[model samples]
Target chain A: MLDAHLRLSSLAHLGLAARSIEEAGDAGIALGEVPRRVALTLRGDGEDAAFLDAVGRALGTAPPLTANTVASLEDVVILWLGPDEWLVNAPAAREDALQALRSALGDLHHAVADVTESRTVLRLSGASARDLLAQGCSLDFHPSVFQPGMCAGSHLALTHVTIHQIAEDPVYEIHVHRSFADYLWRWLEAASEPYGLAVVTG
Target chain B: MLLITCPWCGVREEHEFACGGEAHIVRPLDSHTLDDAEWADYVFMRRNPKGVQYERWVHNDGCRRWFNMARHTVSHEILAIYKVGEPKPEFEG
Candidate 1:
């Protein structure tokens, strides 16, 4: 386990060190097959109700999920990426799912992107997750402001990253690209040292 | 090297912006009428004019929006920049 920990570089080796955006099942936190076509979608232009309803049906859930909780619309999960933009991360294995959305919602004016190799999700848990984040970011990540079901995107360590507080257990998943993963991980670990951050590995 | 003043992140080097070929090449939504050659031309052809040229740039590392820039290809100087929806305001200073 220590060897695995040591493999994570500490020196800031900037330039494509992280993995691309990934999607997996909620049941398996920090473990799942990385989707091939991770859609970074833009849904601000059209009606979200029909699209959300369709996703809710596919995911075995109901529409109109209240804010402050993670919701699934189908294979694509509604992660509050920002105020107006929600990342619709559909797994590549579900090509039919993507096709269904495109075919049925042609009038929606949503932009779907295939960004599998461009981003990676790093699972940050242990007790020190929040402390590590506070050190590098300007956001007031108080428990009430940034807790479970809260997802925020901003600049971290000179790179663009979106940090999602996934669970009440304080398991926050950090997303960065393959190019920025190493630098971010190292920065995270170093920032977490004071609070004793244990690198969670599979 | 030319420097760009990002409306969001402030002034920085030109390395942050990725050249997006044309400044305003509107894509034809009705592709049924476009011939194969015409489509290819629109896709592949780039106007790398010498000076005072209007070009497209994407703030990949910053705001992540498409914007226009009036850049001199020869000297690598950006004369102006504007957002995608707004028109290029006349150069004031």
Candidate 2:
């Protein structure tokens, strides 16, 4: 019964968010660089094939941002949050791409909000990660089927989450509202201390 | 074991959900023409399906949304699972 008091740490002031990007600045974890990336809203026109094609072309076959490679963009990335949406990850320096996308999809009933500070990203690794996750989550994560490249959305400890399994290192990426990040982080940390959680940040 | 795919969350355990019953029971277009007994039959009667059946399920612990699935009670095999609002997909097979 290893129970450490749970503490919710909010990175409300952290400027930007990087989703599960591997390389980020000094903030530790995948902290998005403040004022770094821009969000383009695409509403009235729906998914502009021409715009997407243009973005795809701008990235020049090798998209600067790591595309999800699953359901949405190139099936590599998916908009799990809503219908007619896509999560486009650009390279480390993609300010230009954002502007290009915006101009390309100009005024079609779309509104993009900069959510860099709206959420926090936590990378939970180590074998015990799954054990710790089992404490509150209701999904069957046994490796037999939930292997790498698979992602699932569910409520863990009553908080909505997007869980992505990146490796057998059993590395997990947790994305939640910035306000709830602290609660979930503390909850996971408390559950993983004994299994030797290697807190990751960069 | 049988795997149930959620429209939003993907596949999950069966225990996390509750069986929601059939997806295709239709009521009469002109209900005024039917007697009270006939109305009750349409509203309360349930067909104890023993073979292939279309059922509804609420992934209470998962997506928390209702969905329809086609399964066989005898074999315990789920043929398909779809959103509750959409029309039942045409059985292609």
In order, what lDDT does every prediction score?
0.57, 0.56
Query: What TM-score would chain B receive for each of the candidates shown?
Result: 0.77, 0.79
Query: Least lDDT summed over 10 consecutive residues: which range in candidate 1 chain A?
Result: A24-33
Candidate 2: list runs displaced more than 4 Å: A1-9, A12-52, A58-83, A90-93, A106-113, B1-4, B7-9, B13-80, B83-93
Model 1 ranges off by over 4 Å: A1-39, A44-48, A54-70, A73-76, A82-84, A90-92, B1-93
For all predicted structures, in order, the TM-scores are 0.52, 0.54
Candidate 1 docks at the CAPRI level of incorrect
Candidate 1 per-residue lDDT over residues A1-202, each given as its tens digit = 1232343322224322243224322322232112233545434432467765654554444222333234564455556442234565566555555556566556665655545456777766555556667677654567876677666555576667766676776777666776777677677656655665433231
lDDT of 1 by residue, B6-55 (tens): 55444545655678777777788987899999999788887766556787
Clashes of each: 14, 23
Interface RMSD of 2: 5.1
List the lowest-lDDT window of 10 residues for candidate 1 chain B. Answer: B7-16
Following a full C-alpha superposition, what root-mean-square deviation does model 1 have from the true structure? 11.0
